[model samples]
Target: MEFRLSEDQRLLVETARKVGERFGSAYWRDLDARKAYPAEAWQAICDAGLCAIALPEEHGGSGLGMLEMALAVEALCAGGAGSTLAQLFMLNPIFGGVSIARFGTPAQKRALLPGLARGEVTFCMALTEPDAGTNSLEVRSFARAEGDGWRLNGRKVWITAVPQATKMLVVARTRRVEEVQRRTHGITLFLVEPDRPGVTHSAIEKLGTNTLPSSSVFLDEVRVEPEDVVGRVDEGWPALLEVLNTERIVTTAGLVGTVELAIRLAVDYARGRRVFGATPIAAYQGLQFPLAQAHALGEAARLLNRKAAALCDLGEPYGSPANQAKLLAAQAAAQATERAMQTMGGMGYAKEFDVERLWRDARLFRFAPVSEEMVLNYIAVHDLGMPRGY
Candidate 1:
């Protein structure tokens, strides 16, 4: 199998790296401290067309595959803008626009794709609720049939970008819980506009990744038309999986980049900072061994991420690969960031150094996209011939 990036992919990676360099740790730190969105950095990424990396050429995108998208996100995170712009841009094509492209009507595509390509409109995936974190089949949100339309009533928590999103892909139950044979059935997905009278959002206070605002959204009898249905009514579980799987793979790429950056920073600091002797801390075998281990694990995770992305680009079966990639990469990132922080000693705890921020941001990966435990369960049941745990 091929192990290297193509010439065009390499060029895209370089472009993302250059664009990301404009917004360094300082900028991200300021935004994080102020709990404000990184509008400038986001606009820069959009102006570079990074947000359109996965859209088709017909949709005003570069027509790149998920591999190219992963490379671009990796480059962005490697340049230290990991916390602010990676998720927004990297997932734009797959999570934001792909549903529309794959399942949207011609009119929907014509109406939404161009603005999304230009970053004029933002989309949020609304699936997770307070009661249903990992068990998405237990969703309590309901979309009842109205006069040739639907009225949705539900509450979604920890929804990213909901406050600023013009539109959202909301997963709700169109049929009652007892009406379906499988809990996964009878669910539906809709693209809901939050400006309607029945929708309201409150921003959540998060410990990290503060650049993007998340909210608890309440939908109270929000009216939607038949045109708003994505894919099919009571068949949205599969459509939502498409987006969530893409999210896992792409987010893993960003985490891989963050781990690489943390390793580099730690190595740089360890090689320069003198301790008990005339030489630097790099002379310490205790520190050197862990640093090497971190580098090796990060590299391994990176390779897995690329493999998953390649499978996605080829339209192959990617569910298992994507979960594996996310699990490995997130673990690697968390370990690498933690080691880097420990290697930096007291300075790592300080926000001025930025390793601490990387540590905090790296942590969200284990819990997001899919939790580490969920990945393990998926592997056990699907790959190991074991019975399903959940």
Candidate 2:
């Protein structure tokens, strides 16, 4: 199998790198310090049309697939933007935009996709409730038919970028879980405006990745029109699964990028640091092996990520590979950042080096979108014919 990136993919990597460089470490560090958003970097991304790479040409995007989008996001991470860039660009444009582009009606597409492509609008997924977490079937949010539309009431927690999002795709139970033969059924997707009469949100303080705010969104009798439903009613499980896989792949790509950055920082410090007066720390294999091992793991994670994204683009079953990639990539990012900290000694812990920020952000991947445990459960049950665990 060919491993080389095509010319277009290479260009995408280069362009993304340039965008990341244009923002630089100082830009990201300042945002992290104040728990502020990456507004400038996002505006730059929008001006460059990076938000629409995965969108169809008819929808005013570059007509690229997920693999290409993953490549760009990886570059963004590698160039020092880290997880913030993904929250600003990928979370909405790739994950939320793809759902609408693929399933929305003609009118829906005409009204939404163009604005999303132009970066004038952004969408956030409101799937995770305080109680649901990974157990989507446990979502207590419910919606009922009202006149020509639906009325929704629910609470969503840990929603990324909700404050900046113009719209949200909320998953709610249209029928009681006990009434449905399968728990995954009875769930429906709704595209709702966050500024409506009954919709309100409060910013949630998270441990890391503060460049994009997390929020708790309250939907109290919010109304959604009939056309806002994505895919078939009570058939949102499959559609949500697709969106999850896409999110995992892109999130893995971001982790891989962060790993690359960590390795670079560690190696650079090792080469320049002099402890014995006459020799550099790079002379010691003790410092070298861990960084080398982290590099190897990052390389492997990148390959798995590419494979998963390729499967997604080909319309093939990619659930197993996508989960594997995300699990491994998250592990690699955590290991690489930890190793970088070890290699740099105390400097890695300092905010100036920026390894601390990456370390914190990398830890989130181990538990979010889908946890490592949940990924393992899925692999065992779906791929290995094992009995369900949870």
Candidate 3:
């Protein structure tokens, strides 16, 4: 299958590149230090219409495909804007807008999509519970009938964007696990305002990605009308998996970009830092070879990412490629960041060079959204025809 981008798609990447570089490195640095949101950068992304990507045009979107959306994300990261800066798009564009476009009812779409497309509505998905990290089906959050609506009660940990989010997409169990034939059953999705009477959130202190905070969310009898539901009740597993695949593909693309940025930063530093008075450290094969390997790794992951994204847009099964792309891209970013730090030596440890920050950010992709071990398990069972290990 051909992977050449159309002129418009190419232009979209270019536009995103400009937007990503406009803030410069200092913008991200300050935000990381202060642990504050990149409010101005988010506004710039909104003003540039990047937030409208990958949604139906009738809902104030750009009518682009997932491939284009992934490309936009990659460009943003490659322009020296790291993953955290690009996460603004993830909340509204991928998780909120695209998912709603796929599964939301007409009324629900009309109520939320336009605001999401405009970046006015930010959504934080509450899926990971303290007890259910990799095993999302084990989530114990439940919603029960209450008058004409449902009352939800549960706790979610490590949910991102809770402070900035106006709406929380909650996943709750409608039946006990024993009542369901499959773990995928009895689950439902609901949208609730985070500032509701019974909802509270506390930020988690993390090592990196300080610009966007992840939180432990508490839900106690949060009430929601039927209109708040997305897709069918007790059938949210497919929808949830689809959103995870979308996230893996697009974020994999961003991870590849981080790999590229880290290599570039290291290379620039290596060329200038003289090791033996006259010879620059770039002459050392140790530093140069690892970056080269990382570049090749990122390139391969980028190809797989594009293929998976195209498959998604074509309505084909892409879980295998998506998982594979995420695995490699996450590794590539982590390796590149580590090498970048080593090449820069003491400067790398210091936040001024940005390698340390990149290292911290890159490390997260290895586990979050999905872990490396889980991806291997998936490939072994689903792709390699091996017996289930987990």
What lDDT does candidate 1 reach at residue 158? 85
lDDT of candidate 3 over 272-345, digit per residue (tens): 99968899999999889999999999999999999999999999999999999999999899889999999999
Instruction: Find the candidate with the highest lDDT and give its number.
Output: 3
Q: Which has the greatest TM-score? A: 3
Q: Judged by lDDT against the true structure, how good is candidate 1?
A: 0.83
The models' CA-based lDDT, in order, is: 0.83, 0.85, 0.86
What is every candidate's alpha-carbon RMSD to the true fold?
A: 1.3, 1.3, 1.1
The TM-score obtained by model 3 is 0.98
| Candidate 3 worst ten-residue window by lDDT | 81-90
Give the candidates in order of TM-score, highest first: 3, 2, 1
Candidate 1 clashing pairs?
Answer: none
Q: What is the alpha-carbon lDDT of model 2 when measured against the actual structure?
A: 0.85
Candidate 1 worst ten-residue window by lDDT: 83-92
* lDDT tens digits, residue span 15-38, model 2: 989998888777888889998877
